[model samples]
Target: MSGHSKWATIKHKKGAADAKRGQMFTKIIKEMTIAARMGGGDVEANPRLRTAVLKARAANMPKDNIERAIKKGTGELEGVNYVEMSYEGYAPGGVAILINCLTDNKNRTAADVRSMLSKSGGNLGETGSVSYLFQRKGLVTYDAEKYTEDQILERALEAGAEDVATSGDSIEVTTTPDDFESVLTGLEAAGLEHDSAEIAMIPDTYITLDNDGTRKVLRLVEHLEEHDDVQEVYTNLDIPDDYDPDAE
Candidate 1:
């Protein structure tokens, strides 16, 4: 879990940089459109849509663009009929990889994803291949400086969080998916702010790699994430303990 937490922290920091480039906004809107289309456009009735919209707002996505996405999903306007898909694979060092995508054409997306994987020394697997190695959990991350650990632990436990831990300058709260919103709401009511909150796939076990292998795994994950159709990439790679962000 700690390894997954580190990966998440790095991913979040990188995502913030991607947002500045405006490339990540496309993924956010696609997610919102798909969420709204699957469930109703009403955020109150759709937790997924609510989360997607919240992320978009946090990213400062335009209000009109958000509204237009909802409209398209609700059929108020015609839009791309995206289909949600997940691809399973392995990165370098046998690290399990799960790729989530939203696309109108499965064939094209699959081909592109497969090619990318093959070129990167990975091979797509059958459904449920590596997926079983991961469990869905709600993760909430906070900057440690924002609150005392005792305070966060008390509120989070009282609000149904299963676990809370501090890593460096960050504190992480974990909960079952069913208890996520409730815990988040409780935190909000208590005026606690989180750095990031979302339901994510946590690996059952992680594969540790040396410097070379870690770099290869990271490159493969980064490449997959850059694809326009790819939304999220989950992996079980435990980043090397000696990794120095500034050294790279």
Candidate 2:
């Protein structure tokens, strides 16, 4: 269930996204609204809503704003009706792409995505074209400085996680999507804290790219990520360890 994207890619995206708090909030709010609408407004009863609310709190979103989003989702308050959508494509260097979106206008979103992909030297693929390259799984990340690999593995296995791996100063735990929240909560309740948790599309394998190929693929990913309707983008890029995207 571990994601195949490079550590450099993750670092680069996180750094950029953190600088755009408003955009980040918009994405989170959309997820919350959709989750509540699909599973009801009660967080305790809706695992998707529980995860969305947890992310909102982690981002320091206002309590009132969270409540209002839930109300809107429950139809107690008026709000935009967003339909969940996904697109599969291949970037430069054959990097598989999975884009999750929440959109009120599918035609516009599709057109924009297709245009961006074509401009970036990629193609918007038909259904199942690129999706077969990835699997849906849940991921939980922890601070490695606070726990040894052995310790994380021990705790994670006991909590029903399928696998654990070390990525620099962080430890990642992978679990079945259905057991993700329970495993995460169990670990937290047992004194193991996680930095972030999410259900994601993880690639079974990765493809290494040269500097030029990497740059092109990264640019395409950045463009797709910036789309207002895009919720998340998954890829199978494995960047070299020494490369610094921040330096660019």
Candidate 3:
């Protein structure tokens, strides 16, 4: 498992996502709309839409809001047309970064991302520059304290999961994109709860950084994630278990 996955688990445990519920809703809604537009409105028939709906449900988004977003995407209601864009970049310590965005204006998004990178000791890379370091996979994480590794491994492997690993307090289950939903359902049936689940860009390797360098890279990721258009940010940074993100 990537340290980034553990960092996300830490954030979830800290209620960072809950603290920004409105912002989180906004991002999920955008994802749902785009997924519906690209695929179809039927969640059962559309894998992307189904994933988006699962994310919205995880956030406790209102059912009505989810329906409305899907309607907009299916053209049943008016909605902003968003273009999907991906930006490759490098964070501090030369850690590769991949940013996925949904934006109405490409020019504005590109400029904003470039400026953020330049100001944060990073620089945007040409297409495919840093993207090659990542592989798209479905990642499902659980609290290690709540579930034993053996329990998760048994259920995950039985459900077609590719790999299962424990990092710090997180138990991460990796699956192919096609098997993601089925694995989640199987886990649920087995009464295994998940902390966070998503189709993420997993790095082939990680760059372990010292405390100070880790903070610098984390700060840069935080800044990028704060942007309205930036949906997901992936990095090869290996966050140390003892590094306190809130420390000064």
Candidate 4:
């Protein structure tokens, strides 16, 4: 779980460059649109949309862009219809991975994903091939700089959180997907701030890798994340502290 948190922090830092790429904004917009379309346009009633909006705001996406995306999703404006897709596979060291995507062209997206997997010593698998290794949960992180471990645990647990752990500078809060919104609201009401709150696939266990293996796994992940159709990549590969994927 700590490894996952560290990876997320790394991703957030990399989001600066990603935000400059229009494709990143497009992906976030697609997520917002779909979340609104699935539920209602009201963020208050739609937790997924709320989360998407939060992420967009964190990315510094413009207010007008956010509003327009919401309107398009609600059919008040034109928008591309995107379908959700997931590809499961194994990377180096037998690390299981699941790539989530939203794409207008399923055939192209699948082909591109499969090709990337094959190029990186992996093979795409049928649905459910790797999903069994994970459990859907709401994973929220609070910065320890702003809140103590005790404070985080107290507020989160009081709001029906399942577990809370302090790892380095972060306090990880885990809950059932259904309890995500309420738990977030609880933290907000208590004046507790969070670094990230989202629905995630928490793997049952992890496979640690050495320098070479971690490099190979990260290369595979970076390739997948660079794909325009890919929304997020979930994996059980744990990179060691000595191995820094971000180091120049």
Candidate 5:
């Protein structure tokens, strides 16, 4: 598993707490609304909306909330007009960072992101500056404790997954964006439960930093994620296997 993948697993474990505060729901709602507006509310016909709906279901979002968000997107009910925006930047150790957001006010979101970066010993870069370091890919992770490597390897590849690798305590499945849903469904049908699944901006190369540097970069990431408009934060920082995020 890459450092970012480890971080994602940690975040997934922390998601219940975040969801209790409604932070997770807020982000997912925005994503669903935007997906519906752009691709329409028909899940079977709109791939983007289908993905968003699947994420909402995975998060245990209420059926009523999901329907309302789709309605808002289709203009059946009033909704905020969100625009998708991405920011490229570098963290404390020159590790590349990409922040994806959906917001009604780009100015506020941009300024807030810049402030968070600057305060954390980082700076925003030009549009394509750090983006070139990442690629969009479909990633699905399963708990290593519950599933064997061989079991995942056979089922994942048979379902059209590109690669399956064991990293730390997790099994990572990689796929093209087009095949993500099918691969996920296949795994589910085969009785494999996943920890996290998403279409993510994955870094091509990762940078390893010392403890203090890692802490600083992660602090910045947490702050960005707390913002209402920020949806996802991607970075190239490779966290060491034994590093405990809660240890000072």
Candidate 6:
């Protein structure tokens, strides 16, 4: 969990950078559209859509834009038909990688992803190759300042969370995928709001990296993330606790 926490911190920092560059909305809108298309647009009835809506709100996306994106997804208005695809691969030092993408043209996205991986000293693998190293779990994170470890554990455990870990400045609560929505509801009822809540790929084990190894892995992830269609990137490289690229 400590390893996961370190990556989470890095991801949040990177997300802030993306938001400033006007890239955040594009990704959020893609999520909204796909969620709406898969499930009905009624957020109350669609758990995925509800999650995406919350993300959009957190990002401070305009309400009108979210609605329009949902409408487009539901075919109430014209929009591109995006499909979800996943690619599994390996980064340098044998670190496993999994990428989630939503795109209208699968071929273009695949070619671009392959090119990026090769350029970054990684290579694409067949489906299920790297995915076997990860488990899909629901992760809900809160700032440590918001609650004590005991407090979070008691409430989150009673709320159906499977595990709770406090590392660095954040506390992460994990739940079975099926119990995620219920646990989230229970947490909200307890007057708590999460810093981040979503389904994530949790690696069973991590390969700790030195400064050079960390640089290689992070560079690969950044390139993968910068692609227009890639929604999420997961890697098993555990950054060294003392390594803070931003502080460099």
Using lDDT as the measure, the top candidate is: 3
Evaluate model 4: give its lDDT. 0.81
Better of 1 and 6 by lDDT: 6
Q: Which is the winner by TM-score between candidate 2 and candidate 3?
A: 3
Question: Which one wins by lDDT: 2 or 4?
Answer: 2
Candidate 2: lDDT over CA atoms?
Answer: 0.82
Alpha-carbon runs more than 4 Å astray in model 3: 1-19, 246-248
Which scores better on TM-score, 4 or 5?
Answer: 5
TM for every model, in the order presented, reads: 0.90, 0.91, 0.93, 0.87, 0.92, 0.90
Q: List per-prediction Cα lDDT, in the order shown.
A: 0.81, 0.82, 0.85, 0.81, 0.84, 0.82
Q: Which ten residues in a row have the lowest lDDT in candidate 6?
A: 12-21
Error of 6 at 8 (Å): 3.5
**lDDT score of residue 18 within candidate 6:** 45
- Candidate 6 off by > 4 Å: 1-21, 244-248
Tens-digit per-residue lDDT, 1-248, candidate 4:
23334434434433333423577798899999999889979988888899899778867789999999998889989889989999998988889999999999999999999999898888888889999999898878887788887888888878998888765567788889989878888988988878877788888877888777777777778788878889988888755546665555
As a whole number from 0 to 100, the lDDT of residue 195 in candidate 5 is 82
Q: After superposition, how far is residue 228 of candidate 1 from its true place, in Å?
A: 0.8
Q: Could you arrange the candidates by TM-score from highest to lowest?
A: 3, 5, 2, 6, 1, 4
C-alpha lDDT (0 to 100) for residue 170 of candidate 6 = 79
Question: Which stretches of model 5 miss by more than 4 angstroms?
Answer: 1-21, 244-248
Worst 10 residues of 1 by lDDT: 12-21
lDDT of 6: 0.82
